[model samples]
Target: MFANALVSFEQMVSSYPGPLMLVTILCPDPHFKKRHHKRRVVQKPLVDSILKNLHPGGQVFLQSDVLEVALDMRNQFDSHFDVLEHITDIDPSVLCDNEGWLLINPMGVRTEREIHAEFEGAKVYRRMYQRRI
Candidate 1:
């Protein structure tokens, strides 16, 4: 996960050269104020960088509990990309079967932080978009 707010995402475009891949972006913490430039990561330029880096037919997966941040992300991607799926549209029965489905982690394990967040009753909102070919 790239933590730098001014990351040059375009530099990583070649990491995947094929179609139908996944790119996950975890936005900066939502509690940051507008004046805190050091912590904000979801700016317009960064979004553009991400779009440029993504391959055609690739999926960009974004997760955040902050409503405002989510809206901003949706707006930015909507203007230049196509949304392929929303978490709610998935079949409920397939959720439990998703364990170990991801390619990067053979075990497909959830991070300890995620488990703690779930137990803490935090709302986790997930959304996915595709790069327009």
Candidate 2:
């Protein structure tokens, strides 16, 4: 694993030669202090890079145990409503509710932190977005 933001998300994403089909920003850094907010992983540069390099119909999966961070991430990605559709907004199955929050992780696989967080009675906020075709 990379150490201490040794490589930014933008740089890592750019290293790929082709557009990406899926991107997961899971259990991201939660800089709780207001002064440390600048160090947070979910920032504009990363978002721009993802949007530019992601293929049409590509999926972006985001999750965190911190509610504030999760909401911030959701707002950042959902801000680009023209290009990105929140899974709940566009899922054809009509399983998503109008409330905008998801009850569980959509990805079949679960990270250890996610599993443990839930087991400890903490909520894991999850959101999925798709690049519009």
Candidate 3:
């Protein structure tokens, strides 16, 4: 698997054999400093690439141990909802709760970071964006 931080996600999306049905970004580095924020993996170019290449009914799954990062990622996708008709349309009963946090891990598996975060009593934030038909 390619490392999200070091890899050009746009190029990865472009070179894939077929439309991506699912894209999962789990616990991306927050890059807390304002100047370093540019290194975030959820930038517009990557978002655009996913939007352009994701097949209809595809989904993007995002989660982070840090609330700020999670919200930032969510907002990035939120801003694109207007143009994509993907974020706003969803089967929420299967995806998330009323407050927009996914109640269950859609992947059905937890990463070591997730388990560690939970064990340490840190809150995890999650959201899903699904393309509309």
Please report the candidate that would top lDDT against the real structure.
2
The whole-model lDDT of each prediction reads 0.54, 0.83, 0.80
- Candidate 1 per-residue lDDT over residues 15-105, each given as its tens digit: 5465436666554467457777445566777777666666666666665555576666666666763434433234333231232121122
Q: Worst lDDT window (10 residues) for model 3? A: 83-92
lDDT of 3 by residue, 9-111 (tens): 7777678898789988999989999999999888887888888888888888899989889989988988877544434345535755666787778789998
Sequence-dependent TM-score of model 2: 0.87
Clashing pairs in 1: none
Tens digit per residue, CA lDDT, model 2, 1-108: 474442466677678787799988888888999999888888887788889889999999999999899988999998998999888778765344445667677888
Ranking of all predicted structures according to TM-score, beginning with the best and ending with the worst: 2, 3, 1
Superposed Cα deviation of residue 81, candidate 1 (Å): 3.8
TM-score of 3: 0.86
Best by TM-score: 2
Clashes of each: 0, 0, 0
TM-score for every candidate vs. truth? 0.63, 0.87, 0.86
RMSD of 3: 2.3
